[model samples]
Target: MQYVRLGKTGLNVSPVAFGGIPIQRGTAEDTKAIVDKMEELGMNYIDTARGYTVSEEYLGAALQGRRERFILATKSMVRDCSGMKKEVDVSLEKLRTDYIDLYQIHNIKTADFEQVFGEEGAYKALLEARHEGKIGHIGITAHSIDDLKTILSEHADQIETIMFPFNLVEIQGEAALKEAKAKDIGTIAMKPLAGGNLEDWRLALRFVALSGTCDISIPGMGDVEEVEKNASVCCDLSPLTEEERTEIERLRKELGNQFCRRCGYCAPCTVGIDIPTNFVFANYLRKYGLADWAKDRYASLKVNASDCIQCGVCEERCPYDLPIMDMLKKVEEDFAR
Candidate 1:
């Protein structure tokens, strides 16, 4: 596997890190098998979060004797020093490690920065942890361009790494990511596959790696085959050919700007709508040419898009500022036909 220096952190890491979100869908044994494959290929970097249910615990169990082989990274949503300090201890305990290579402020926004970087904010706690040898570096993850812009411009000296969504279609973060890279802050492409919207995983990953903006891309992997596929791409880093470049344009035009990234920030829908799932099925029906399967899946949902009461609650939480009510209305209309 190919390795790159993770910005100022000075940690040599795999170009394609192992994203730990998908493991929650599997069993402990399944996680072990997945981690076993990652170890076999020397993937060497694992990114998980406190919010990803059971991901930290399962990864901790799987890392067992091999914890030192990989650079472990995780994030939390708390914004205060006390809360973040407690979270660091919890993450260490859950990850079954004495030291974490990277600890991040998860999904930070422009409005939360004042409090987060305050005298008694999460940043203080992370600095304290790094000083005490509990964490090696500090990073931030965000879905907003404004937030990334702020970090790269004014707060670049404060953060060692910055993660944001980057894919063939979602190149909105391109300029900011480039700026971050220029500043020597590790730039990680979070939704490298456009939240599973892109079918050509090889092209999707290659686009980000060759883009010159991002240092690494973390595509969520649940199985050994996925690890093998993503690792193979990293090992054989090549420029996109003319045909692939043309295909990239086609995908960008086809997906447009309104599609969901499946970040799941728009949760606890007032009416219990599985918002991302609805969008996924809709995409399958419209884009994947799987109308019957998509219809079946939508039918199985207890509350589909058509059931949306248009309460506007989800739109408030969506970091991308997508018009959720209107998008769901379109999904409802498409599935009705």
Candidate 2:
């Protein structure tokens, strides 16, 4: 497998890192088999989060005796120092590990770093924990490339890694990746396959790897076949040919303009609806076989598409300029049945 240096951490991670989300859907034995296959293929970096239910526990059980063979990275969404410390301790116990290779502030979106890095914020707790030998490196994951750039510039001394969404559809991180490389901060690419919307895994994986900015890609692989296919792509670092690129372009065009990028730029709905989340559940209902669960979750939303007041405010703010009212209407019509 192709090994790349994980920025300032100085850790050599396989280009294809194992993502622990999909494993939560499988049986323990199934999860164990997938982990074993990844280990056998020399894919060492494992990324999970406390947000992903049962993922850490299953990975902990799978890697029980082979913990030393992999680099474990997990995240927490807690914003306070005490809560952050508690979450880390819980994660350690669940993972059956004494220390995590990387502990990250998960899904950082708001400009709360001033509060986060302040004396009472979680950053101080992370420093104390690291000094006490609980975490080896500190990192942050964000959906916005701009936020990551800002964080890197402000806290370059404390931040060892940065995780951002990098996929075939959204090549938004080219500049951020360059900056991370220049600063020697490890770059982790999430959604490498465009949240499984892109069907061509080979082309998608190759494109990200060839960018030279991606140190490791943590694609969610729930089965052994997926693990092998992903590992094979890393094992052979082949770039996509012109013909393949043309085909991908054609597919993108054919898929048309209905896909939601989940950027959430059109947010703070007047009716208090979560626009991106509604679209996410809608996509899962259509693409995957979680229709029942999606419907239940959709029903539980405080303000779903059905509650949209057709204000046109969200559409005006959308960078993609998507027809928010029309899409929400469709979601209401389709999922509310």
Candidate 3:
């Protein structure tokens, strides 16, 4: 497998890097074994989030002795300076590292632009961290194409990298992603396997590995086998076979409209429900068969899918035209069963 430059960041990363979301369902020892495999296979990019419960801590334990072997990336949702400053410190401690390769403003929305780039905003905190050598680069992750456009057009110089959903079903951000690449902003595909919705793991990994839009695609790997499976795609950087192309088209038609991209655009859901998150937990329950874990997470939410009051406001805001109320009702029914 060959290393690809992460845009102009001077870092060469594996085409199929490690996504840290699924490690929440595993143990620290599991993460250690997975990381060990990754190091052996030269899959050296690790991305995690401060919101992913124990993910950072597990990776911290796993990378304790060999922190220099990989590029460690993590994100936070805090938008204010003092809070983001504290969040960065917390991530560093939890990852057991003094310096992170990339620290991102996680899941940023267009509505957050002014505050995130303004005085006393989280960007200032990141700049401070970079100046202090606590982090190597600053990046932003958005789920919306409009937000991606705004970043490239307005603030491309401020961030070194960008992460958004770019998969067979969610290429809505393609134009913006291309523009980001043109500007030399490192592009990261956050949910390469369509958030666990797509079943053909090998083809899904190959699509993103060969796709020129993103410098790297991060598919979540729960254990060592998953890590190996994803890493194997890097070696087979061959063109998509005709059968794979047909299957990709079939999947796009089947899943293009209904799936939630987890962009969080349908905010202020009248009833305080996180619409995208409800769908996410429902996917974990139904598709991934992570029933107990998904149910536990769903139960923890103050607002569940059942809380939807049938208001169609969210659907109005959704870019993908997802029947959010109907989907929420289904999610409610799924959990009830």
TM-score of each: 0.98, 0.82, 0.85
Query: Which residue ranges in model 3 land beyond 4 Å of their true spot?
Result: 261-308, 311-321, 330-337
- Report the error of model 2 at residue 158, Å: 1.8
- Best-fitting candidate, scored by TM-score: 1
Best by lDDT: 1
Off by over 4 Å in 2: 251-258, 261-326, 331-337
Please state the error at residue 207 of candidate 1 in Å. 0.8
Candidate 3 residue-wise lDDT, 31-53, digit = tens: 99999999999999999999889
Each model's lDDT comes to: 0.92, 0.84, 0.90
Q: What lDDT is obtained when candidate 3 is compared to the true structure?
A: 0.90
Q: How are the candidates ranked when ordered by TM-score, highest leading?
A: 1, 3, 2
Residue range 236-317, candidate 1, lDDT tens digits: 6777899999999899889898888888999999999999999999988897789999999999999999899989999999
lDDT by residue (16-41, candidate 2, tens digit) is 88888888778889989998998899
Clash list (residue pairs), candidate 3: none
